[model samples]
Target: MAKKDDRGREGEERAARYLEERGYRVWDRNWRCPQGEIDIVADDGRDLVMVEVKTRRTDRFGHPFSAVDRRKRERLWRLAHAWMRAHPGAARGRSVRIDLIGITGERPATAVLEHLEDLR
Candidate 1:
């Protein structure tokens, strides 16, 4: 795989671990529908969180969170709706929120991670 792809996967894993540690029950990774992909689907008790994981090798270009543009957000919203429709039982009682997990640096080192809630 390409270097950037590998980095992104690593970031997603890190985000999963972080959420797990915080008591989020992870339901899916890379949940896909016709609209787009959701990096993580987790149940946070009262809500379902659709997460976007962004990883950057360096902070020189920009922060990883900045990568989530308007079009991407819209696609994620559509995908989340599709996921809920496909699993109506899981959808009814809970709220939906879009979250962002930004990670910086390499593996085997301290990766800086930030969780931004309710992005959409």
Candidate 2:
């Protein structure tokens, strides 16, 4: 994999661990379809969470979370629907939520991470 890809995967692993520590059970990672990709899909007990993870080596350009723009949010919404359709049983009895996780640092273990939930 490319270095950037490795960095992203590392960030995602960190994000997954973070969520797991908070009691969320992760069901999927890097889920892709014609619409787009969801970095993480997890169950937070009462909700099905679709997470978009953005990782950066530094904030020289901007914060990682700032990369999730309007267009990206729209794509995530579509991907969330696609995921539900593809995994019907998982969606049952659970509310759907969109979440964003941002990580900034060279090392995954010591990265600065932020999670924003419930986008539109």
Candidate 3:
């Protein structure tokens, strides 16, 4: 895979581990459809979380989370709805939330991870 793709996958994995460590059960990774893609789909106790994972080797331009602009957020929202429509049971009881996971650094061991929940 391309270097950037590799970095992104690594970041997603790290984000998943971080959430799992905090008790989130990850249900899917890299879920894609015609609308868009969700980096991670997880259950955080009482909510179904749709996560966007952004990874950067350095923040020269901006923090990784900065990449998740309003347009991207809109696309994510649509994707979340698409996911719910496809998997109705996943949203039966729990609330749906959008989350952002930003990772900055070259390696997982030293990467800085920041998770922002309920983005919308």
Candidate 4:
């Protein structure tokens, strides 16, 4: 795989560990529908969180979170609903939430991670 792709996969793995360490129960990784892919799907007790992970070797352009623009957020909501429909009662009474995990560094395992939860 390309170096960039490796970094992204590493970032997702690190992000999953980060969330798991914080007590989030991760149920899915790289979940996809016709719309797009949700990097991570987890339950944080009260809600189902759809996570978007963006990894950058450096911040020369901008923070990874900047990639998740308003249009992207809207798309995530659509994908979240699509996932719920596909999974039936998996989300029962919990609300759906969007989260962004941004990682920047040469090594994703030791990269600086910034997590923005409950994105709007």
* C-alpha RMSD values across all candidates: 1.4, 0.9, 0.9, 0.8
Q: What lDDT score is found at residue 26 in candidate 4?
A: 98
- Candidate 2 lDDT over 5-92, as tens digits, reads 9999999999999999999999999998987789999999999999999999999999987888899889898999999999999998
> TM-score winner among the candidates?
4
Stretches of candidate 4 exceeding 4 Å from the true structure? none
What's the true lDDT of residue 52 in model 1? Answer: 91
By TM-score, the better pick of 2 and 4 is: 4
Tens-digit per-residue lDDT, 1-120, candidate 4 = 898888899999999999999999999999988988989999988899999999999999999999889999999999999999999798988898999999999899998999999999
- Give the clash total for candidate 2: 0
lDDT (Cα) of model 2: 0.93
RMSD of 4: 0.8
Q: lDDT per model, in order?
A: 0.88, 0.93, 0.91, 0.94
TM-score of each: 0.93, 0.95, 0.96, 0.97
- The collision pairs in model 4 are none
lDDT tens digits, residue span 1-120, model 3: 799989998999999999999999999998989887899999999999999999999999999888988999999999999999989988997789999999999885469999999996
